[model samples]
Target: MRYVTTAGVIALALGLSACGAGGNDSAAANGSPFGDCIITGEAGSSPLNLISDGVVTVKADLPSPGWYNGDTVESIKSGFDYCLLANIAHRGGAKGLNLQNSSFDGLVAGKAGSFDMALNQITITPERESVMDFSDPYYESTAGVLVKKGSTLTQSDLADSHLGVKQGTVGQMLVDKTIKPAKAPAVFPGDAEQQAAVAAGRIDAGIQDLSIVLGASVQSGGKLTVVGQIPTHESYGVMMPKGSANVVAVNKMLKEMKDDGTLDKLNSTYLTEAYGVDPTTIPVWSF
Candidate 1:
C-alpha cells in the first residue's frame, strides 16, 4: 500500500477552498485554474509519483527500502529504467524519466503541462475509470488485519474489535461495512502510523493491504502478526489522462514487461521479501 502526505491533503483542501474564488474569469481565461495537470497519489511508495505538466515529482512520505527485497534506492533507480527499456526494446514503448526524489516540495516546484502518468497502489473503481485511463494492474493485494505478537486476538476474534486503518482505503471500507465494530475505526493517513497504533496497543488491530502488513511486520521484527484476512480485493494501476496519446505508448511497454517476465521478476525479487509469499501464487482477479 502507498502513503498519503499531509501536504497533499492540504493542497487538496486548499483547492476545494478556492473552488469558487475566481469563477468566470478563471474559467474563461486558462479554462480552469486547476487545468494545470497534476498527479495525486500515495506518497513514499516506490511504485508511484505525481507528474505535473510532464515533470515527475516525488512525494514526501517515501516508503522504506527494507519493505521489499529489491527496495534499495539504487534498485529503484534501475527498476524504473525497465519502463524505458521496454520502450526501446518493444514497439510503441513509452518514455519515462526520473524526476524528484519523493519529496513534497520537489513535486510542487516541478509542476508545469500534462502529467504523463501517475502510478501508485491506486485501486481501480468504475467512478475513477470513467474519468481516467489506467494501465493493466501492476499489483494485486487484499485487505488484512494485523495485531501485536502474543496478543489475545485470533482470526476469529476481530469481528468486535476496534480497528486502525488508513482512511479512504479498501481495508477501512471493508472493516466499516463487514466488521462494523461498535467504536468508530481509528483512521490514519498511512500504513506506518496504522502499524504503529497496533504495536502500541492503541488499537486492538489494524486493517491494511496484505503486502503492506507483511512488509511492516517483517521490518518490525515480529512485533506484529496477521490476525485475520479481510475479504476485499484491490489492485494497482498506472493512471493517465483519459484518452491521452501516452496511454497507448505506456500500455504497450507494460505489455512487453509482462511478456518478457520482467514484471514477474521484479515482483519476485521485491514482494517476496516484503510479504514472504509470491504474488504469482495468488489467484488472478477475473474482472
Candidate 2:
C-alpha cells in the first residue's frame, strides 16, 4: 500500500522483505504488464481458467473500509475493491466472486499461482514486478490525516505534534519531506497499530491513504475522525502472480470500466454514498 521512494520502505512496510520497491516504466516492455499476452476471449462469454471452478478468487486484507468494507467476506455487502473485483469476476464469466482474507505481507510474497489477483491499494513498481504481475493503473489516492474524535489539534499543530505513520510508506515520506513535524513520527508495521495508536492517544495523528483513514473514521464509532488530507501522486493497480495468464483479461476489463464510467460510478457508490465521506470536501491541509 506504500508508494516507492526508498525501495526498502515498500519492502518492510508491506512485509515483502525479500525484494526492493520502485517504479519502472519498462515493466510492460519487460513482460510484467502482460505485453507478451494477448486477449484470447470475449468478455463474459468465455470463462477464465481460474484457480477455482466457476469462481474468480481475489485476495485482499479484508475489513478495510473504503475498500473491503467488511470484517470478512460474508459481511461484505459493498466496497470499492469488492465491487470492482465483482465486476471483474462477472466480466470473466465466473458465476461467483471469492474474496479471501490474507496478511498484507503474505499476500504479496507467497500464494503464487493460487489466486486470480489482488486489489489491495498496491502501486506497481519495478521491484514489485519482479515478483508479481500488474494490471493497468486503476485508481489514484491521496494521504488522509486521522485524529482523535473531538480533538482540538488542527493542521496548524502538525509541526509540533507527535505524528504517527505506518512504517515504510509514502505517507511517512510526505510527513518527513513536507510536514516536517518537530517530533519524529511514531512508526508501526500496519494499519491496525497506527490506528490503535491514534485512538488511544499515544500519538496526535496518523497519516495514510485517504480511503484508509476515512475508513478508519467510519469504523471508529465516534472515537476518530478525519480532519484533513494531503494530495499525493499515487495510483493503484490490480496485482497478480508473476507471469499470470489472466493479466490480459484483467487489463481488458479495466480498460472497459475506465472508458465506460464504471470506475467513476464505483467511486461514488462506495467512497461517497457508502462511506458517507466525499474526499473532495475534506480540507487540503498546507503544511
- Which parts of model 1 have CA positions greater than 4 angstroms off? 1-61, 64-96, 99-114, 277-287
lDDT of 2 by residue, 4-102 (tens): 221111110111111222111111344322111222234585346687776777776655565655334455545566667767776788656666666
- Inter-residue clash pairs, candidate 2: none
lDDT, candidates in the order shown: 0.47, 0.66
**Candidate 2, lDDT over the whole model:** 0.66
Task: Count residue pairs with overlapping backbones in model 2.
Answer: 0
**64-157 per-residue lDDT for model 1 (tens digits):** 3322112222223322222332232223321233322232112222332244554434555554677667776665556556789998876555
Worst 10 residues of 1 by lDDT: 10-19
